[model samples]
Target chain A: METRTQDTASFEVTPWEVRGKVDYRKLAEHFGVKLITESELEQIRKLAGGELHYLLRRGFFFAHRGLDSILQRIEKGQRWALYTGRGPSADLHLGHILPWMFAKWLCDRFGVELFFEMTDDEKFLVRDLPLEEANKYAYDNALTLIAIGFKPEQLHLIIDTEDIKYLYRIAIRVAKCLTLSTVKHTFGFTDSTNVGAVFFPTLQIAVAFLPTELYREETPVLIPAGIDQDPYFRLARDVADRLGYPKPCTIYCKFVPALTGEEKMSSSRPETAIYILDDDKTVKKKIMNALTGGQPTKELQRKLGGNPDVCVVYRYFQAYVDDDSLVSKIYNDCKSGNLICGECKLILYEHIVRLLQELRERREKAKDVLEYYRISTKFR
Target chain B: METRTQDTASFEVTPWEVRGKVDYRKLAEHFGVKLITESELEQIRKLAGGELHYLLRRGFFFAHRGLDSILQRIEKGQRWALYTGRGPSADLHLGHILPWMFAKWLCDRFGVELFFEMTDDEKFLVRDLPLEEANKYAYDNALTLIAIGFKPEQLHLIIDTEDIKYLYRIAIRVAKCLTLSTVKHTFGFTDSTNVGAVFFPTLQIAVAFLPTELYREETPVLIPAGIDQDPYFRLARDVADRLGYPKPCTIYCKFVPALTGEEKMSSSRPETAIYILDDDKTVKKKIMNALTGGQPTKELQRKLGGNPDVCVVYRYFQAYVDDDSLVSKIYNDCKSGNLICGECKLILYEHIVRLLQELRERREKAKDVLEYYRISTKFR
Candidate 1:
């Protein structure tokens, strides 16, 4: 139950939802967080060209840093790898899959090796979880990741803190490029515990460079994660510049929202999100409760219309169920009062059921399928 | 640079040291820190018998915890090991060798494995040495340690923090047994850097258990260190008890007095102590400037006599030269005004030269000794 306060501000505009103090660019500039300008974003769209079919429109390739140079390198046939992870705090939720799926897609799209860290050390230093419990959580989470159809050859899943410890010494060398003050400034951590909690972002940076140093030759990395995770790679990119390693490019998409319509679909509240372990009834209950802005009546839609943009279900359609024309048609009809909110939610509910049924059944049959150790350690 | 206050009130009463506001037993007892009482310590001595030597004349190893059971097991022919370190801050002074020499003797007497850590991590973290510089210091320091003539098959050396991180993870688990409140209370550190700084004590504990775990057998350890370091190991022994691992026995020796007649010989002040690396000229200069308890004149010495018990040069003979009978002969003759202080100082200076000459040569020529690496890693 992460509460959302919209952080009320001054300006109230007429007819549209633009507000005061809500300038994304101004906020980004204020914080020195480099964001893609409209022109740079257009350049990305033009550069992606045919790749946009699988990338942009479905929101697969969203946020980025130094992406233009990355694309130029890719165009010149320079390869990049993948970096992603899970906190393993609770059950794996829809929020967790967006990044891993993006990373998996990038692996197929660009023949890149993927490194998935379990970050159990992070949990060890931060959470009160027992080491064995953290280890078990990592093991279980790895299985859930495998069930998502990640190619065995491309992924290296490291769950142990010890493995990461030797790995972190290298990471700290990169981390040393940034001061604790600088880190604390960006992270807003006030205590020693805060430093321990934030230690993984440095490790995340090392994961990008590890392929080049640990594997054989230099391998660049492409991190696919939530927009919330962009700051980690931003620091990674900064550390790379100082440490003389290739910077990791990132594709940070917004999270797939929960049924309750929030910024994130957290698993702490089970009612708002569907789990891979969820049965048909549970999935149905969650989807039916999902928020939608489709019109309740044709006359009301013609009079007041639906705010399809703010709807959580609409956001999901924009993220996961990636049929562009179908979603666009649904959006237009709902906005024009042709499709009602109830009918639209019912359809999306069925789409999710058909989408996840086979995966759930297979997941139930063999819990051991996820425990494939070779797939984890060797990463093929 | 250390001065000992002449306070007969405490007369080596340890339970209340350093201002008496802190409760030693109550603080230790709160975390189930097993506090072996004075009687319990005597029981442990009975069980250990002649296997472990105490600095009894000095009252250094007064505090004990779980030592009775460990020594009982040891007397019954159960195995144990030793753990110690070299900071490589500078060349080893007489004070540095006091612990290692005693440790080497214990290893010989008890037939236990010894682990010598070259604490480059601690040196770098605590002091201002770069990793490369710290490593070079360790490399150089290893030669001096090898020059001490420790057995090749008993000591394991770990210098790189990068290598030690995972092995340290087990120790960090014990450290996790401690809270920030506990560690801060013990160390009085107020920052994140303090955690890594104070972690060496935990590393020492892990080294104590290495034979049992790493060698894959059931055994304990006896950590031989100066009394100043005893405070740190008290916490380590506490962690061992909590983890169901055997609590390590500790041998706390009194400090070897500086040539300048201070309470301790410190490497920090060049004028105060003779270092292993000191040449004949430097050694002579240090001894000539050394503080003495002897009277300035023949008239005063004949009238007041010398305080040989507090004489720094006399302590040197007691710590290093091994011929206690010769030291007694000189001590008794000087106090009676039969021997002059200058003549005594000259004799002590020559003993230093003669003592270090072989070591300097061995350290200089020991480069070709592949045996040193074996000794360092305890592989031979």
Candidate 2:
């Protein structure tokens, strides 16, 4: 009945839950993934024509399973695709879009297709949300992905329930190779777990192999996702060879620290995360009231410097701010008592408002072209 | 790990397996089902305008759940449909067609639709057959169902993987209400079972509720299936009210005894069962060698009469023979030491050969209209 063994560990991470302050190094080791190395990063930077996405530069997307093989295939000009997804349980947050942003960069740099899945069926199965509500969120999430600037031709949006005719066959193929024991071990499933939830990982695994069936070729897939999702792809990778599919490669990013300073942004606690649809006033308020490591009083903060290492505001700047020197200056200024928490909060507020404004405009246009980005297959 | 508790009960019956000499009375009692009363049979005969299918008249369909309500609905002229299916793991044997034959009668008598599902996905998951093979068999089985005389307009053929788009949403809804514990207890699922196999019951449950969605009304479903399939509908009935669908009614038939005199005819032992497509020569040979309740020699057989109660050939006659007096005459003649085993087998053989010969011609014609019977929905 005890489905997980992470109780003794300082932090727990699963596809459904993240708790406590996580140690990324130990977590990677426990998950059997290697930390991204400097050489690989340099190779990626060269592949991207001497520029790196801030996510990689800031070391946020820090672990991987088959990055070397993916890189090798890319270097040889062999075709591959970027695969990632969302659960559509709630509105997208900055944390939810982190991997998609990296996936977009991978798509642009490598000129490969991207399979973005909205697992509406999974959300419906695992949560109390109705199927219609989950499906509505799936389309809503697709708009946001389009707002993030993925090209219609390059992106294939797979909403699980809507496209299940195409997905079910592949999912069953993968499902036939998967045992309940493996799912229970990986996702911490118990007898009380709904069979739909236990069977859902196969749908996720199927997306990794979708392109192969779609294109009539053995296409390689690279998945950039939150570290919590490693278990699904790990199981996918385990069964890939047996199913005659290329093992999907993965690059995992650390969780985005919540405004309340939790290890991850959670949809359950609305105040801890800033949703993409949050109005300007809400965004400004959330950012200004965010947790920081500054002293309690202004005079005390000027005498004793703030700790950027533990500050949620600094984490946001690292994730959103593309300028390396600017981030460094802010960090140094805060650590040296030269910058106040209020000023840092205001700067982050401005950056987020500007980013969201652009996204809102693009999101409106995304609605008009939503059909173009949807996956089409002969199966239907 | 011991998935069944029927070991001490003389026979075992699950959705996937049937073993030993099944005691129908004990099995019905153990499964918490009721035997069809004489009054109920008379009501059904009246409903069919003073006649009943041979299967019902001869007590082959010996048990039921919710029959009174179904009869009441029929009396009130409320809309209802017949539901039955095949797993399509192999060629359709005579045993496989028993329920469908009963279903066809119900459809004709009531002028109601029939929903025939070929669970191709389940076959692939539970068997070593490839997906294509299962799908091929699904189409093949569909042809036979048509040959059995189900009108294309009245029959909705649901091939699992093909019609999954329509079924998936409903399946997940049912699945969300189903826990692994329920499936395990119902179907003998263990940790080593493929997750696809574990989740398959929901698809079946979805089919029972499908007409409610298709017609936008809470239509009652009457499933004519082998007793082994009772567990699925039992689980379906348990969840139906919660899902706002009518609790599907079931009429359970005792298994068709194999030629070798096993309690159930299994497709795995090809020689023990006559497939729908078996040639006249093969059918004759199988029937000639079939197990019968005859004495060691013809002289002894003539002296002591054949035992019709224990004869496999007589079981087939009881199923296929429509004339009650003729069947009674065969029984009386055999018991009175007038009819020999070979003569009785030849009579049964001639009936089957004529039946199969007409079926083969109809089956060839069924190929031309296979697409007409397939279920279509706006979901695709």
Candidate 3:
């Protein structure tokens, strides 16, 4: 029943909270990031060797801070690493996987390493969850992340509490360059906020420069994450030069709409989010009952045509459906009233169920490969 | 040229900064800690099963919180552990070793384990010092601490950055129970304070609870430190019950007076402090030039007695001189104009030089035993 709202005042986005119907362009503008232009996408397509990722091609990953500079550096034969993180408060959902999928593609194409930070500390600080629970979720999420086709050697999983001995030195360095005023302004923190929550941002910033420390070389890092996470990177970018590390380049993706058509899918609301572990029956039911732009009557939709723009089902198709031609056909067919909501829902459900089933299978096999992905304490 | 200030407004004491002349009794009253009473001293003397330590008899370790309970717990056969720490911003000085000397006494007398934290991270956050320099100081200070006669098996050295993997989990739990408002009020943190500085107290608190985590038992911890550090323990005591850990008991000492007769000796002011590594000649020169309460002329000093109560030399004698009769004779002679500043300085110089020489030799030997004193990552 939720309707999209264009009122700029109504929407909110931060690393910790997301609400209302977000206007992507306005959000980018507010965050001082640039929308990824077609020419830039063409440049990436060339770098990717004649094809762009479906997420990038569809404009799901639509914004950036320093993407052009990263591309330039790569062309000049400079090596770069990819860094991204998840606050493990709960199990992985489809919305959470969107950016990781793009990051995996980036690593596969670019032949670069990935530093995956599981911020168990952050979730423990922000959520009512226990540290042990957050740590459990971190291992669980890491298994799911490892299943997403990342080469074990290329992926270095940095669980916050486990890898803190290495991260803490760099984090304190980053923390020194930041003040309470800066974090309060950046994260909208109040006096009532716990000191752990106030200090968690430094851990995130440290991950960006971790490669430079671990490799003993100034390696540029590219982060592909949701636009909501930009603030941490923004603060990182502000302090990077001072800390003698390259400012991390970030490509931001728009939020994946909830099944109820809310701006962002959240794990707190189980009905609105489709978790990666949800069985085929659960996935089918959630998708079938999802919000769509079809008309009230099928006969009226045949005369009036349907609106594909506002439909959560169509949005899922746009993000997950691999074929450009089929997505185009679905868009056209829905607009011409040829495809009804139920048919569209069934199509999206089939794609998701298949993706989840394949992921679950790989996840079961990921246990054996977990050791290879972990960034060991001995690595330091 | 400095004079003792009785104006409460003129003196300030916090974990990071101290100024003016401190009145220990008033400071303890303001901090809501109880002054060590005669009966408490008798209880401790009975526990030692013989003579009391010179520092305890002389009232150098003056104030406490929960000492009675700790004593009662000991009588009931409940073992206790000791926790104390240093912020390794510089090499160890004579002033810095005062509490550690008492901690060694407690360990020797009571057969308790000790957790010694070197807060390199805190110094890196608060001072202009680099992390590496702070870390270097930690090692250097650890050598001196090991030389202080603690049994290697009973001592666990926790260098903040090195042991962060173990400390960080407990720290986050402590941190979650503390708010920005609380730390701001406790530590006098302002908006300009770095987030790392704000979160550093939790590391200190975690040390108090570390034995419970490491040994898997509800071990009570008692901290022996300067009165200035009470705020950190005060905050820890507030949140310990909430975290299901024992509230740490604290014994606070008055600051060791500077050679220049200032309230506290500090490393930044080299003239005021005598470094533990200072050669004998350097120690002699610093002591000879030290401020005293003698008359301007030698003839007047014979007619009018010097003030031992305000003399830095007498204070040093009281703290370091083991012979009770010798300290009392010096005090009475100064009061009766029988002892002059020169003779007293020479007597104190011999005592200090011998102490330093013995410590230096032990410190050199400490390098061999360093491995046994370190709290290894594997200990977790």
Candidate 4:
């Protein structure tokens, strides 16, 4: 069965950037995540009018699928829609930017209509959360997302508890198009979890193309997400093509690393990643205690400086820093013993601390974020 | 451990009714369905002031959790609502009247709001129905239900395929409260069917109380149904109670049997049941072929003319005939070797044929029934 093959392939491939030190080239092919070729990157750069500097290359934006076609559409003045979502687990993480940023990029370049899903209902079902608590979490998550500077007029956000009939209709149609074997294989569920878990994949696939389902005109979507979730989007792509809609292209960005560099930058593990609400002291401590490639003693570090390319601090710079030229300069200077790990780490920490604070302030003033979320329906 | 016990309880308690001749009383108890007591029936008759001929027996309505409370509140002139639904599976069968009749009783008695869910979308997902076909069935089913004499002003119908956003918000929330274990156990799925199948129970529960989920106000509902569906209501009861809302009471009536003296009547099996659309000649042929308890020859017939108690035609008299005195006369004459099976069957056949002709003619004029299905939030 196709399901079994995906399971076999998921195991064999998907080398999680565990410890956050991933070989970008190897990861691209391992997950079957489409990546821009040398020419494709050049084309993307040209499409941006030499604005390649805004990208997160060597950071999290690692893979692509049919990304070139979307670019071609943009070049031809044809619009595309942006589709992406968050699970609304507990809190938002820097790793969450992997998809949102790419979605933002598509929106800016192609004037794509964006649909953002706050899968709070799904989180509650799978996580056994109380409805009130789940709803609150969804609201909080939405606020944080709005802070990220996604264009309000192009977005559509939904929470599961707000209405129910829509879910049933979408769920049934989704369930009909797919099968048990497909979902069981995709989610890797045992005989224990509920049937809701099995039937949930269709909702995800539906959310990825919800705009199309809502209107007479079908629109193809571009789903931007992290490499960890490549399988889900791949399933979405499969459902899309099968449903007589064009498959959604994926930009499978790499995950942001934590202080421990344990393949992901998760808030769940406090040591690996910093939260948006973290104070300056906590942020500094995390970065100071973070695992690094610098030699133990300062004297030894002065003699052997640091392998900046291998350091966690440098890794953060590659992901969050806006200045690519400065990062490249730091990398070269550190290799020649001109830059120290502690100093480079401090610089990275300062950038992240500033970014999170600025984001929080911006979120506070985001006008009628919920209204903004509903704006995507116009295109549909 | 709790999940396992609940699943086992569901399997042991739920019972689907069989056609021809079901042990309905025992089946109702096994599934935890409510049934009226003889004492209750006596009270209903007394309350009716001997006008029992107009209403379905009041005693048949039992297992109410909030009906009495809702009624008392209504008497105090507190606002309340009535909820009911129809599965758009096929033409509305005579069996579907259990819920409508109950809803009519509630509205007339309490002056409450009435809402009807055209479960076309639910059918689409579970039955793999096309969207247009699903809508068509809803329209067809609605007209038949309306012809039963539901007032236009007192009823509100919802077809899920229309106005997706608000409805989806409600369905997914209910989906979150449910688990696959509950859904699978309810549906009798054991490592069979998809997650969509598991997810379906939640949708039914969602429909059972869409108002409260949408408005954040608890609403009491009485779901009138064939006793066969008690298990589903039992599931709904649990969900409603857990959600801090009132569990719906059930007023389940027994199914009407086919003319063949089978346990249950099935429209698909034409020989087993009389359909609403059956013409005069077809109705006559079906009645003549109907199973009877009479002697084959004249010599034997003189000894045993008929046992009307075991005859399908006699049961029809018990269900449809307006005059109880006439019913008793027919039974007495048959037992006393006066009324033969052929003559008794003809009388019943004539009554049903007349009704069918009038019903079918009206059904033909119920054009554009879909116009009544609206997604408006306002009651007026």
Q: Compare the candidates by DockQ and give the number of the best one.
A: 3
Give the runs in model 3 whose Cα sits over 4 Å from its true position: A1-10, B1-10, B303-305
lDDT per residue for candidate 4 within A63-158, as digits (tens), equals 788787787777887646787777675657777765676666666765777777776666766766665677777777777777777766766776
Candidate 1 structure quality by residue, lDDT tens digits, A1-380 = 11111235632211112234333344334334455555655555565453543345554454566666666766787766677777665577766776766677666666767778787766675566776777778877777677666666767776646355435455646645555445444544443433344444566667778777766666677676655555566677777866677877776554566678654565667976777667778887887778777556557866776888888777766666767888898788777777777777777777777757766655564375444433234532
Candidate with best lDDT: 2
What digit string (tens of lDDT, one per residue) describes model 4 on residues B1-380? 12111223222222333533345455555565445555555544554454443336423334443345554554465545666676685645555665675566555654555667776765665566676787888877776666555555566676656544444544455655555556665666655465565665655566667666555677666666655566666777776766666676666665666766666676467787776666688788988998877777656756777777677787777666657788889888778778777888888887877666666765666554535535364432
For candidate 3, the C-alpha RMSD (Å) to the true structure equals 3.5
Off by over 4 Å in 2: A1-9, A296-305, A335-338, A377-380, B1-9, B377-380
Q: Which RMSD does model 2 reach against the true structure?
A: 2.4
lDDT of each structure?
0.62, 0.88, 0.87, 0.64
Docking class of 4: acceptable
| TM-score of each candidate structure, all chains considered together | 0.78, 0.95, 0.95, 0.85
Q: What DockQ was computed for model 1?
A: 0.20
Q: List native contact recovery per candidate, as a fraction of 1.
A: 0.06, 0.98, 0.95, 0.49
iRMSD, per candidate, in listed order: 5.0, 0.5, 0.6, 3.7
Which residue pairs show collisions in model 3?
none
TM-score of 4: 0.85
How do all the candidates rank in terms of DockQ, highest first? 3, 2, 4, 1
Comparing 1 and 3 on lDDT, the stronger one: 3
Kindly indicate the candidate among 2 and 4 with the higher lDDT.
2
